[model samples]
Target: MQIETGVSLKPYNTFGLPAVAQTLVRIEADADVRRVLGDATLGRAPKFVLGGGSNIVLTRDVSQLVLKVEVPGRRVVDERADAWIVEAGGGENWHDFVTWTLDQGLPGLENLALIPGTVGASPVQNIGAYGVELKDRFDTLDAVDLITGRSVRLDASMCRFGYRDSIFKQALAGKSLITRVRFRLPKPWQPVLGYLDLERKMAETGQHQPTARQVYDWICEIRRAKLPDWTVMGNAGSFFKNPVVTEDQCRDIIGRDPEIVHYPMPDGTYKLAAGWLIDACGWKGKSIGRAGVYEKQALVLINRGGAIGAEVVTLARAIQESVYGRFGIRLEPEPLVI
Candidate 1:
């Protein structure tokens, strides 16, 4: 409930970038929500919602109100024979939520293991990994309408999920604040290992149909091996989204670079692996000043110790130019830069 001015954001963000928020408010409860936003003295101002601070790039000091969503709780409101409906507060840490669900023997969320972010922001970006996305198990969500100053609950259909996107990031955009999320999880089990990493791990382990917990552990291992930890080394995960291209464009890209890995969509279009394209473009592991690309994964840009936000943005732009020039595909940044 404490509101501070010009607070140092080095601890809040994983990248360790020292960006300052003009006014930072941490709302611990639902009551605190209106109390902070309705303050007459603060007046109307630009604001950014910060969660676990993953999936974002703090490129510069934000001269606006930064409302750090901290409203937190959970409830096993409904239970069935096959699956259970578990609800979590918006401020609940994403990994903690996953761990708690796993301990409860809940299925479905095992594939989302170790993803660093807040539960409130999950639906906003429709976070995904391996072969699963949040939308796959989405039941419903409750959010506060920023304009109406009222709470609302939306179902899976209303979310309009698509390739790491949702109504929150599209139609709803910045007009609402997610207060709670409900997930329909299976009680029994079903481990999806269709992805290359899981499949490869299964082969190495000489086992098939591993338990949900096992899948979680394996995924955590795989992610740690490729993605750098933001605590020690600075990074915002994958910097660019995989470009979904037309069939002809895909062919043109593949014709020149046959080694380009692609995922074919059900809609007939193809998604070019952004990491492969960036790595192939000779930008992978390449550093300019302090900001540079991660060596293991080409899609991630790292802040090597003291990299400035402007420098990071510049490097990202450079990568975009490279990818666009090489494949005629414009790469889009995944981070919500403020």
Candidate 2:
């Protein structure tokens, strides 16, 4: 395999932070991983797996070997009586794959439309939007062990999925490269319209029972209006995850700040709106160096033209500190920092 050195990662990551990979290799298939393991120098070196570059904040140049996963394929693998099973390569663009499923008459992925990232990265973070998460439709995934070069297939239970988390972010973090993922879209599709934005979309259109296509279109519209376009603004969408607090903790905060935005989880926990907390702390349209809180949505931290990774981290830290100081809830960032 040919190695590329001194590659600029600015265009690769959504944040557009300046960083360089000293050595990089494109893993187009599982064989590519095994090939690297068989190599002498590359095999012994630490490796960093990169996907669509959507959920990362590059803080410095990488000395470890960078495996840029580019494996590619997509198709309906099975049409069972209960569901249609779809599979896509890890390298495929996630949004495009979702659109493809819709085009093929599969309605399960409509809620996840327009989420930026590759298919391989989805399960790692359990990406979700508009009241639906990747875990809901996940069937199985094939991945290769980075060190052993052995391939393994994991079902949904083995993934240990949680709110924006999975085994890939825990026990197997940085230890494997996902090759492909399969999704099970159940028959008789149901629209997930519980989210406030989707409910508003329903109210506006007067379509209480929306088809999958309608839901997909509404989600895309809602995201476009709320989230900054990464191509234009250079931001990792939703800089912080919504913090889930216990019912008593939520009540305490609600009593102190009557207008605090929150939602009750089925598990009896309360998920506080991180954006609302940051906005309440007066972070919107504020900047620390070149990094700034997005004026339209406080949850997103943007690179205000030519910003460095450290500046973004600094701005995020300031937001966290302020939110914790005011609300006594520490905000956790969503993106992986490296």
Candidate 3:
């Protein structure tokens, strides 16, 4: 375990928000986590597990011990007639891992291409895009308990994955650190192209029967066109989760606003586009202090150069209030505000 003190976390987090970690420990393996837990001085202190820093907003200097996951490795763990089981270190770059799987002739992860963050953070957020969520492809994960330092393997059901959430974000939040994750990529790989953007790509390119690589390229293209590069501009991809509502609630809102963008779910509910709601509320390109909504996509909040966490929070709160007032639906933020 490599330890540092008074570390400036701006470079670590994608938001580029100013914050200092009083104590930061780089955990490269399960043993590294155990070592930190075994340390007399560090063991008892409150801890925060950090992955790629893609899905978080650091609102202030973190006083608790920060464990930066840096575990590394990826491989085809098992192969069978029905599926291919792939495993990756928690610290592995999510998008890079997805690309690697495709390079190795594994195709299931293609639709998740270009998503920012580490593999460990994937299950925590139950990250999804283009109609595919991490839970759909997940097999099992190994995590070490924060208090006991004992490693445990958990299955998909144990994770209790829901829309953009999982056990990691709930009962296991900050209580354990994921070291590795495995995915079951099924055989006869079928492409998931039901999302509107993928459909549009198919129509535009006349490649309805695209391969896995084609789907990966298409997903990358779609995301790049919509979301800002975190390196160039400090921001999380999406600031709010698309709110799902009952059929009656959706119909009630649709009656007043016929142009609202919504998708019917298998459960007979509706997933209203959070970006559309924000844009309709006149928040697109709007700013509060140094934090501003991305002009191209209302779903994103950008740090307009030297913006602090408070500014982002202030801006987000204002947008949330406006969206709730207009739609009668509360927009939940996707990022973990620290």
**Which of the numbered candidates is closest to the native, going by highest lDDT?**
3
Candidate 3: tens digits of C-alpha lDDT, residues 175-213: 999999999999989999999999999999999899999
TM-score of each: 0.95, 0.99, 0.99
Give the Cα-based TM-score of candidate 1 against the true structure.
0.95
Please, what are the lDDT tens digits per residue for candidate 1 over residues 126-213?
Answer: 9888888998788898877765567788998999998878887888876777888999886566778888888899999987979888
The sequence of per-residue lDDT tens digits that candidate 2 reaches over residues 44-95 is 9999999989999999999999999899999999999999999999999999
Can you give the lDDT of residue 134 in candidate 3?
93
Cα-based lDDT at residue 102, candidate 2: 97
Given candidate 1, what's the lDDT at residue 75?
75
Ranking by lDDT: 3, 2, 1
lDDT of 3: 0.95
Single out the weakest 10-residue window by summed lDDT for candidate 2.
Answer: 1-10
lDDT of 1 at 247: 94
Error of 2 at 98 (Å): 0.5
